[model samples]
Target: MIHPQIPLILTALLFSAFFSGMEMAFMAASKLQLELQEKQNSLTGRIITHFSTRKARLTATLLIGNVFALVLFGIGMARSLYPILTAYLPASWQYPAVFIIIQTLVTAILALTVAEFIPRSLFMIRANTMLNVLAVPLLISYYILYPVVFLVVGAIRLVVVKLLKMEFSEEKPVFGLTDVDQFMKKSLYQHETEKVPEVDARIFHNALEFRTVKVRECMVPRTEIEAIEISEPINALRQAFVQTGHSKILVYQETIDNVVGYCHQLAMFQKPTDISSILTPIIAVPETMLASELFVKFVAEHRSIALVVDEFGGTSGLVTTEDLLEEIIGEINDEFDEESLLEQELQPGIYLFSARQEIDYLNDKYNLALPVGDYETLGGLILEMHGDIPNEGTIIQAPPFTITVLSMDENRINTVQLVRQAELTAED
Candidate 1:
């Protein structure tokens, strides 16, 4: 039931009531600042734009509203207590203690209930309404009492900020990467029981984690690159290009040392007969290009692979649109992309593999930089480590992965099984 002394009760909490209005006014001013910041919207950019404005509004509103609320509340409480204070006790003790108790209790009630809880809730729910309703009257109140309120409070603000050695700013709340992760975790859907899928949650976590990994961790290395030499026979180049099933080829003049440019296969289909026309240049990329930049370059050029180069004019490796895209989204499979049988099942968290499988590709997936230069693939890396090619069931220690030769042929390493050395984290 509404208390019979509704106005009197409100008047008793008048300090709080006015504070609530002032707090809401602060929120309104903050909203205006945020709108200004959001004009060219970006989370970081908007936050930066609003930072000073938010601080200014928060400070000004807090100061002005607080003073006005204090005055109103002091008057209301004193008006309520004047008679009781005089009648109940001797003059000295009655006035002093009563004034202290009333000031403390009423201030506590106003600050906790009206000023804090109500204003915060209203700001969260209907920021605009709070701003318009509360800020307008409070602004008028501030003007009416500026001489008294401004001088004392301004002195306090200046003194506090200076002594603290901090620039004046309003504290703003923010969420961090880990905080977002935890927040998403708590936001459960009643119908959907599954926490973001093991794969998907990890991917989200990885996207957060992606900022931590640089491009070097996921780039193709120089040794296994299958690039076309300017002098390479047209028939051989064409056969290799077709066999590799790559969309773009890096055409280098000598030893991939003199990279001229790139040729797209679609262009190659048109010039089937002209031997000179077949040699197309490729767009080259520097190894230092971040994953973000590589993506931008790929989008603009409409090309997939770029030859990773060094400052001294030597071919480093290659990166494809598919490779760069992997950083943002998890692994994507194209029609040409095939997963080895070893990948489909996690038998003992391991897989059996053909010894002939290119180990460099294995390295690409796991980031295990094994010794892979002597032969073409992982089997070759093993052969180079051993005096001669080992028979099936041969165990090897390639960083980030462990491989056992399931089978091998006399001519080359044929079939083998492999497993990751570490638990597969999505970021990898």
Candidate 2:
């Protein structure tokens, strides 16, 4: 037969678990998810939104409720266990100190495992779901414990302001990057299961990651820049504009490193005789500058093109507003842009790629899991490993991948064929 105290202990444990699980669920639930739900006018969403807005009060309520439940649990546990221990244990174990030690160990083990760990773990796994399921109950609990929570919070604020002389502000933005990022991750996971579309998820992921992208990662390298000497004749500039098919041609003083300005193809209509007459000043920026920062600068300055320079102030590459925009919305090609970069999978796990293809792009698209370092592109990776420009048809081993130089110019690699070793082994 079960003792009356047994039911009391179980009830206390259940209440304790509820408070602990609700607290974990509230903390782990994505704010963006909650915001979206709230927009839909759902009851659970409204309740969660209300509680989330008063986060301090909600947290205080949970803690206070948990303390009360734990106290009841301790009393019930002591009452139920004292009789069993006294009946079964030796005479020496009946001492108050010894019984207290044993009771603490048993209570701690039961409280931590059943009422804390299990519920918190399960609640955190499906936090939004748990919150939605328990929203009504949590709302009732919030009101029931509001007075206690209010006093506790007021006391804390009083101590902080009067004794510690510190300012306390609970103001937080409704949503942040972390909330949006978590929502995107969930969308991507759903996409994998064919439950949602991936396009928006990928775009959001790119936008969130755009802040960390450096100018050098997206800029057109110096070797690929189409520029002419500033001292050159106006006819020479026109010829360059026609041959390169570039609207804006950079103007250099003595060498490409000393870029003075640029001449727009539209300037040709003015019938300028010298290159300097039509030259428009171009802004120079460090290659290490963040792409997002560059975008802000461009918008503020009302400029489109910027020359990316190395630490020595020598020209490293060139970037435009379009390039920065591509970091988020993805590649945007105008009529003047090249057809496309060479990206072709010849066979299973074997492919041809332009040396200019970014390492991150290939790794993401093909799941190549290629090693990344200071380099940004396939050519850069090859150069880093080989330490010199390899002639065409030169085979370079880069573990799990065997890269063959398919084409090259006097200075830079143009294209390469990559073969995955694991695929070849499986075929064999």
Candidate 3:
């Protein structure tokens, strides 16, 4: 026959586990997910939303419930064990102090492992689901224990605010960047499992990371800029526009490094005789400037394009508002963008890429673990490795990768072929 103490001990342990698991589930569950559920107006959703707002009260209730359950467990355990221990132990060890020590040790071990660790871990794994499943029961317990919780929490707040001169505010943002980022990551993972498109998730991920991107990461390089000397005639500028098929052409002083401004194709209809007569001023920014900051500057200044400069104040590249936006939204291909900028996979481990492609972009798209340093583009990587401008047909060995220049002019690399030697050999 079961002892009367046995039923009390078992029930106490179950309540302890429930309270402990609910506490962890509340802390670990996503606030954004909770807010979304709250919009559904379900019973569980309403309870969770209410608890989310009064977090201190909820936390106090869980802790108080846990304490009561643990107290009951200790009482039941002591009563049940007393007779058994006294029956087995020698008389010298039957003292109250010794019995208390043994009882405390056994109770602590059982409570920590059975009531704390296991339940907390399992609940935290599917925190949102666990919260939704147990919301009603938690709410009932919350109200049942509210008076005690209110007194405990109110006393603590009073000490903290009144006696200690500490400020206290219970307000919390409904959601934060971290919440959105985690939500996006979870959605992406779900999309992968469901084999659904993840374009929206990818864009959200990019926007979150946009703050860290620098101007040099997105700008068209200096080598690719098309410009005419400021002293050049209007006809020469008009011819440049026709040849490059670009609506706007930059105007430089004596060299491209001394870029003055840009001239628009529509300015030609006004019959401007000189390049200076139609030059529209462009902003210049440092290469190290954050893309997000630059975007704010662009909007505030009512400008769309800016020239990026290095530390020495020389022109580094050109960045348009479209380019800045593309950092978050992906590529925006206008008519001016080169249609033939090569990017293709010829085979499993072989690829053809435009030399202008950013190293980070290549690494992310193709899983190329290429080393990143002071350089940005594929051509820059080749230059850093080879220590010189490579000619057409030139082969460069950057371990794990064999880069061969497919096409280049005297100044800049245009296209290249890359073979991942290790990947190919492994497959073979």
User: In angstroms, how far off is 75's CA in candidate 3?
Assistant: 2.3
How far residue 56's Cα lies from its native spot in candidate 2, in Å, is 2.0
Candidate 3 Cα lDDT to native: 0.89
Higher-ranked by lDDT: 1 or 3: 3
Measured by TM-score, the strongest candidate is 3
Ranking by lDDT: 2, 3, 1
Task: List runs of model 1 lying over 4 Å from the truth.
Answer: 1-67, 90-92, 95-106, 117-213, 217-224, 253-260, 269-278, 298-304, 310-314, 334-336, 339-341, 344-428
Tens digits of per-residue lDDT for model 1, 1-428: 65343465465355455556445544343332334335646453353334334554445545566655556655655565566567776767765767778767865675577666775676656643455445445455556665766575567678779887766544544334665454334433323664332234445655665665545444565654566776666676677668878666667766667767665667666756533475555677666667777677778977666777777767766777776667667666742244542433345446655554556566666554555663546665677766676876777766666777766556556666666656454325
- Number of the top lDDT candidate: 2
Per-residue error at 42 for model 2, in Å?
3.2
Worst ten-residue run, lDDT, model 2?
190-199
The estimated TM-scores of all candidates read: 0.53, 0.86, 0.88
In model 3, which residue pairs have backbone atoms overlapping below 3 Å?
none
Candidate 3 structure quality by residue, lDDT tens digits, 355-401: 98889889989999989998888999999999988889999999889
Model 2: number of backbone collisions = 0
Question: What lDDT is obtained when candidate 2 is compared to the true structure?
Answer: 0.89
